[model samples]
Target: MSDLTKLNSPELSQFSHILSHAVKVPGLIFLSGQTPTDSSGKVVEGGIKEHTAQCINNLGKVLDAAGSSWEKVVKVNVYLDDMKNFSLMNEVYEKLLPSPKPARTCIQAAYLPNGVDPVIVLNHPGQIGAGYAPVLDCHTAHIACKFAELLEKIDRRTNKSIEANPKTIKSGDSCIVKVVPSKPMCVESYNDYPPLGRFAVRDMRQTVAVGIIKSVEKTDKSSGKVTKSAEKAAKKK
Candidate 1:
């Protein structure tokens, strides 16, 4: 008989099809990377510190389901969207994982699973039909520049309360635009991770504008409700 068994937890049933939670052999067990999502599949609300805690909590569930414990964990691998969060993430890691911790490796990833926020910064003035004009319901491309190499197609955007709610943004206007990515992507605030912060606005093949991240709002993966929000001061020209 192959002394191998697959481990699972009822709390993680929603993610069962994605992959086995863990695998156990005679003397060792291998676990998949646990995200900061809850049992209901919603990303927990908070910063990296809170996120790190949730990941470990989820891992504990799988560990218990496998008849194992964190004390037996021999190795660990952490993938971070931004290395700048290392210190904050480490603070939580040190508190949760026991001493004489498992061998671990941490690396910055170009992008993660959730999604990114797109804020447009208009540099030049919008010309009537000559320059770029973004309407309320039009889809546009949000190209991540700097460190993150991602091209996310935005389905639509909401206008923030600025003077009057403008339906169409001209090329040179200064205002806040809220956009949702067509797909999930990893992104960080410009203040927190500058490399993942800068991006270019594209309409078809033309680059319309460029901007830095002012805020981030993450939606629930299952319910699609806004769960977390982070804001930063927009730079003055």
Candidate 2:
């Protein structure tokens, strides 16, 4: 077997049917392109700003997991579905990355997945201490196919949520930024959280999972009794 070591996160593994989050071979680490998606692989609904934030947040998570950080990045490749959003994406990108920014390139592509734009790839030097490799990098792409079933669940719940309050939500607008999975807890952690807005988790996927958190809330509009079965049925549908 090649001495290549694979780096993966439970969150990324949740989408393993599509791609490996990252692959490492001592001196180099390669990360897959990250799109704005939740833990269950739902495409984020916000515009390019949200998409860019989600992409960078996802990358940062993987880099931290692999013993590297943005400061170590030596190169960057940005792919945009349209050139018009170039300035907007850069505004967010520059603010998030550390000083002495890495060499960079930006290009407009004919298309990007999930109708999303500005997929970013970071190439950085990995941790080189005490026997670990010294170079790291990452790329991301929108997810599909592998996420069909999960998407179905989400869609069903979304339909149910809309049926509950058509006026309050015309489209996907709410997201669950924080989840206490073990406790079976889910809530709208952020008020009026934008669709596909970026959320993150640091150092604890076991206790918490974060991304573009989105979920359909099932509550009785009149009596206000939460419908547990309704939510479950929606997910099963």
Each model's Cα RMSD? 13.7, 16.3
What TM-score do all the candidates reach, one by one?
0.49, 0.48
Q: What is candidate 1's lDDT per residue for 1-237, written digit by digit as tens?
A: 489887788886344433689988888888888888776555688999999999999999999999988898888999898899999999999999998899999998754544444344434344212122332111233323211111222222222334433344444344444444444555656545544555555544554555556567787789864332223111112
Candidate 2 Cα RMSD after full superposition onto the native fold (Å): 16.3
State the displacement of the C-alpha of residue 210, model 2, in Å, after optimal TM-score superposition: 28
For candidate 1, the lDDT comes to 0.58
Give the least accurate 10-residue stretch of model 2, judged by summed lDDT.
228-237
Residue 104's lDDT within candidate 1 is: 95
Best by TM-score: 1
* Cα lDDT listed for each candidate: 0.58, 0.45
Q: Which parts of model 1 are misplaced by more than 4 Å?
A: 116-237
Give a tens-digit lDDT track for model 2, residues 1-237: 498866767654254433578777767778887878765556567888888888898888888778888887778888997899999999999888889998999988654544411111122122111121111111121211001111121232222222321121112232111112211122331212323222222221121112332333445547744421101111110
Q: Which residue pairs in candidate 2 collide?
A: 32-139, 33-139, 33-140, 33-141, 34-140, 126-134, 126-135, 126-136, 176-213
**How many pairs in model 2 have backbone atoms within 3 A of each other, for residues 3 or more apart or on separate chains, i.e. clashes?**
9
